[model samples]
Target: MSKILVTGGLGFIGSHTVVELQKEGFEVVIIDNLSNSSINVLDGITAITGKKPIFEKLDLREKSAVQEFFKTHNDVKGVIHFAASKAVGESVENPLLYYENNINTLVYVLQELNKLKEANFIFSSSCTVYGQADELPITENAPVKPAESPYGNTKQIGEEIIKDTCKVSAQLNAIALRYFNPVGSHESALIGELPIGVPQNLVPFITQTAIGLREQLSVFGDDYPTEDGTCIRDYIHVVDLAKAHVVALQRLLAHKNETNFEVFNLGTGTGSSVLEVIKSFERVSGETLNYKIAPRRAGDVIAAYAHTEKANKVLGWKSDLTLDDAMASAWKWEKHIREQ
Candidate 1:
């Protein structure tokens, strides 16, 4: 089995991807600085996969450390880079942090990968790059709008960096997966979205509020011109999102990518509004959530789903989980963690 490297493997999405990789018989090595994640997540992954990956607590921002890591792990055949800081509100507050953590770390990783005989890279990208799309089901052809925040800019810049690098470096094959909202946890309720501070994403917030960790959930807006006034987004299960990473990596390793650099959107084609999500959560958890409609948040898109033809036809990957399934798993995870 080829040795695969997963940066930020202890994170919510990364951990699930690591499990999927291991299940596919890939030997995995994980690198995490533990900035936004915890050491406990490593245990959750081990419990689910029954394989303890080699873990290094190193920050990618340090160029020397990154260089040393690649040298030490020279056997690594594939690299899934997911170590960037990923909070929209915080990025707006401190643009420098986002640039340093997101851009600089990406540059360091690519520099080392370029030195390898053959490098297969999977970049953790977000839908933020598309911003508020002009069309309803956004596709790979959707013109990337101006990034509304530094966090989004980092993703856009990161894709451009990979695209440019791949144009010249025939040895480097990279895929940037622009994923929409990722929610839920593993079926075992072992690993899930457990952010350190107050959760910024909706699923975590709903789970926490139901668990009594939060007073109430706040729907950002109810005035958007959608079926429901609230903003709409494509929320895919974390497990489904994680599986796509493995599939993308295999495409690169198998030399199946038409271009050295490729971009794919990982999302369910269906859109769910805030109120719809709440109703789903209530239906699944049997707990009526306390929520209020606040002012429309800045930089929020009216609605954003995906046109899944590319990912489905090309990558042979499609999200099978439903919004209700995600909510059920998330609620189970929240209860499991709180009871302990």
Candidate 2:
């Protein structure tokens, strides 16, 4: 069995990917600093998979530590990098931190991989890179606009770095999956999103509000030119997004004479407005949610979704879960965390 290393394995997306990788019969090792997540997520993962991954508490920002980690785990076949400071609002306030953490860690990891004879690398990119795309159902060929915020810029820069690195390095092959609004939890609800402070994403905030952890939701602008006059997004189930990473990794390992770098969009290909999401949550949980229309957030896009034909055609993967299913699964996980 080939062993794989997942950075930020304790995070929301990383944990789900770990479960999916384990189910595919891969030996998994995780590296996390526990800065924005908890070790308890390991228990949640084990509860569902009945197998715990090998984990190391190491921060990738430290150059020496990252070098030593790769040295110690020299046999790692592929790397799935999910570690980064990913808050848009916070990134604006602290741009340097985002640049350092997001850029430095990726460079360090790639540096380590450059030594290997052959290695596959998967990076977590975001739809924010396509700021207010001129067209609907954005594709991988969509032109990347100037990033709206520092956080989004980091993702753009990260992708560029990987592309440049792959240009000269024969040992590394990379795929950057540009994701659009990943939400929901695993079906078992044993492992789900665990936001540290106030939740930045829509589904988590909605779930927290339903559980009374938060008093209400903020619908950031209703003046946008759309059916509901609010921002729209393609919310993909976390599990489906997780499965894409595995497929991307497999593709990199199989293909030869392929460009060392490639990108694919991961989304449901359907747009959902903020109002629609709240309504869906209310229907799923049978709970009234308090919300107010606030001013437009500075960095938010009015609407964005994906044209997933590339992923579907190339990787033979498509999202299987629906919005209602995502909401229900998230609500179940919220309840489980509250009781525990």
Candidate 3:
């Protein structure tokens, strides 16, 4: 079995991907700083997979530590890079931190991969790179708009960095999975999104409000052109998104005649408005959410989903979970977290 390195493996998506990788018969090694995640995620992952991955408490920003990690673990077959500062509002407030954490860590990881003879590099890119696209379902070829925040700019820059690295390094084959809104949790509620501080995403806020951890959810805007006047997004289950990483890694390892730097949009190809999501949560969890309409948030796109055809045709993957299933899973995870 090939060993795969998962940076930020204890995080919401990273942990879920670890479980999928293990289930697919891949040996897993995890490196997480635990700055934004809990060590207990290891326990949760073990509870689900019946096997705990090899974990290291190392920060990727420190070039030496990352190099040492690669040096010590020379058998690593591929890397799923998920370690980054990912908050749009916080990125706008602190651009330097975002640049430092997001860019530097990627550089260090690529530096290590360049030394290997054969290695696959998977990146966690975002739909924010599209900014506010003119089309409804964004495709891989969609024109990338001027990034609305520093965090988004990092993804654009990160993709550029990977492309440039792949141009010179034959050992490196990279895939940038441009993700849309990723919500929900693992089916067992063992590991899920544990956003630090106030949640920036909508699903977390809705879950928190339903759990009574917060006063009420704030619907950023109710005046959009969409139905019920709220912004629309294609929310993919976190587990489904995690499986995409596994598929992409397999694609790269199989040498499927793809470009050295390829991009795929991972989404369900269906848009759901904020009000629609709230209703879905209510229907799934039987909880009425208290929310109010607020002014349009700056940098928010009215609607953004993915074309997803490239991912389906190339990687042989598609989303199987529905919005209600995602909400139910998320509600289960939120209740479990509250109990803990």
Span of 10 residues, lowest total lDDT, candidate 3? 251-260
Off by over 4 Å in 2: none
Ranking by TM-score: 1, 3, 2
Query: Alpha carbon lDDT of residue 127, candidate 1?
Result: 89
lDDT of 3 at 115: 92
TM-score of each: 0.99, 0.98, 0.99
Task: Give the Å shift of residue 93 in candidate 2.
Answer: 0.3
lDDT of 1 by residue, 84-199 (tens): 99989999999999999999999999999999999999999988888888897999999999999999999999999999999999899999999999999999999999787989
For each candidate, what is the lDDT? 0.94, 0.93, 0.94
lDDT of 1 at 91: 96
RMSD of 3: 0.8
- Cα lDDT, model 2, residue 64: 99
Residue 58, model 2: lDDT of 95
What value of lDDT does candidate 3 attain over all alpha carbons? 0.94
The CA root-mean-square deviation of candidate 1, after full C-alpha superposition on the true structure, stands at 0.7
